[model samples]
Target: MDYKYIEQLLERYWACETSLQEEQILRTFFQQQEVPEHLMAYKAIFDVQQEQAEATLGEEFDERILEMIEGDPVKAIPLRGGLRRRSFLRPLYQAAGLVALILTIGIAAQHSFDEEGQSQHTQFAQTDSLERPADEFVTVPETQEAAVTVEQDSINLTR
Candidate 1:
């Protein structure tokens, strides 16, 4: 028999241009016992397709799968009342901690400022005690006349 049609179909099949009906025809042609010697190499391919087409899952397939899945039941974790309460108050606890931290920092900064202000006040008091009155007499050196000058007048002029 002339195999020009089958050869043409095989070419179209390899090029992926065959219709489903054309492919079925090729499978049927290759399934025959007397495939030509030139086309014998492709016969095994069609035989495997026919075998796979005839294959069927057993009746117990679904039952076996369901048994395997149900064999080990997943345990559910029960939520406790204390865990729920803690989760709900988590944000409140965080806010309270933040407030306590801020208050601690504020109190520390206030104490530091108070200590610095007290030290500055003490320094100012000490300097004020050591300062001489501007009205007191200041002696001139012997290079000039021995004059007991009023220091307040010179201090006022400089100011």
Candidate 2:
């Protein structure tokens, strides 16, 4: 039999260029009992591929792999709806706290300004009382003393 096509496909497979169908053809051809002496050497390679294709893991494969890696079988914990509700309200709670902080600062600043204004008004009133003339002055019996007192009052008025 002419095996020129098989030889060509083997060349392509060695060069990593064979399509899936062509590779399957090679595997099937090698599976036959009587293979050409020249191609007999490659039959073992295709036989291994066939064996691997038919291989499967047992039903406990996943559990065994997990146990090997983690040393124990891990159970999945179900999450509560409360976690979702808390996540939804987290931003609202932060916003409320921020607003309260801003209001506190604003109130403190307003209170400080009001106190400063009141102090200024009190200082102005004290200065105004000091500048106002007294209701009574000391009466001098002597004319010379009265003249001295009048001159002193004139000097105080100028100040």
Candidate 3:
């Protein structure tokens, strides 16, 4: 048989125009008892291609990849160097502290308001008790005046 057709297919194969069937045809034709002298140069290339096409990556490949990875040095984290503490309850602690600070401020403000009102009321009562018109809304009650008079009498007695 003339090797003309095989030579044309090999030419197309090199030019990247041959179909898969044509490539298989060329591979089959080359494996004959004797290849044409000129085509002999490509025998080893085609035989290697055929062998590689039948090959698959297997457990040996996985083992080799793992061994290469395991051979590298492991990275270490420093105990006190740039690491921050992580806690699930840190937000709760912050919120509790914020609440305590706010409550303290609120209680302080309330106390200041109460003290101001009490001081104002005591000043008003002292002024009213000293002397006031009979028709005023806050004329001194007789009972409160009597208590003051009693305290003064006690002081006079002690003297």
Candidate 4:
């Protein structure tokens, strides 16, 4: 019946000057069953907002959502000696740590084996460089005399 007042309030609302009470009055006026045809467009917006405001979920909603996400029932296990809550990611952290440890060990073992192989190659090269051919052997007269004297001393000791 008095659409003039509602129009004035809407103008103030669009200009960002309407108070909260005035906005509430506008909403309440739109909620009436017999809305004017000219104001029918705004009626839908307020009606949808009211419906959304009234929509609610039951107490089991969170449990159902958690079950759907985790594929199992979630339980709050209490800590034994601490007051703080433990995180659900603790197991994931442990698993990641185990994987990191295994990877580190594997990498270290691989590096160690590589170093051993390299050292063995180096040792072999050094030994090869130090080795002489059989033809390079030469006998000296002093060595022969020393050998004979050593043999004679051994014979004297046996006697």
Could you report the Cα RMSD, in angstroms, for every candidate shown? 25.8, 25.3, 22.5, 23.3
Query: lDDT at 112 for candidate 2?
Result: 45
User: Residue 57 in model 2: shift from native, Å?
Assistant: 1.0
Q: State the C-alpha lDDT per candidate.
A: 0.56, 0.58, 0.56, 0.56
Write candidate 3's Cα lDDT for 53-97 as tens digits: 888889999897777666542323223432223234445444444
lDDT of 4 by residue, 1-159 (tens): 678999999889889999999989988998999899988998898899899999899979988777677663244443453323234444544444444334333433443455554333333322332231111222123233333443444344346
> Once model 4 is optimally superposed onto the true structure by TM-score, how far is the C-alpha of residue 82 displaced, in angstroms?
9.2
lDDT score, candidate 1, position 71: 58
Q: Write the per-residue lDDT of candidate 1 for residues 1-159, one digit (tens) a residue.
A: 899999999999989999999999999899789999989888888898899999999979978777766655332343487766665766655554444334333433443455654334333322332232221221112101111111222233346
Candidate 1 segments whose C-alpha is farther than 4 A from its true place: 65-159
TM-score of each: 0.40, 0.40, 0.35, 0.39
Q: Where in model 4 is the C-alpha error above 4 Å?
A: 62-159
Weakest 10 consecutive residues of candidate 3 by summed lDDT: 134-143
Pairs that clash in candidate 2: none
lDDT of 2 by residue, 1-159 (tens): 999999999999999999999998998899998999999889988888888988898879988777666663223433376665665666655554444334333433443455654334333323332332221121112222323333444344346
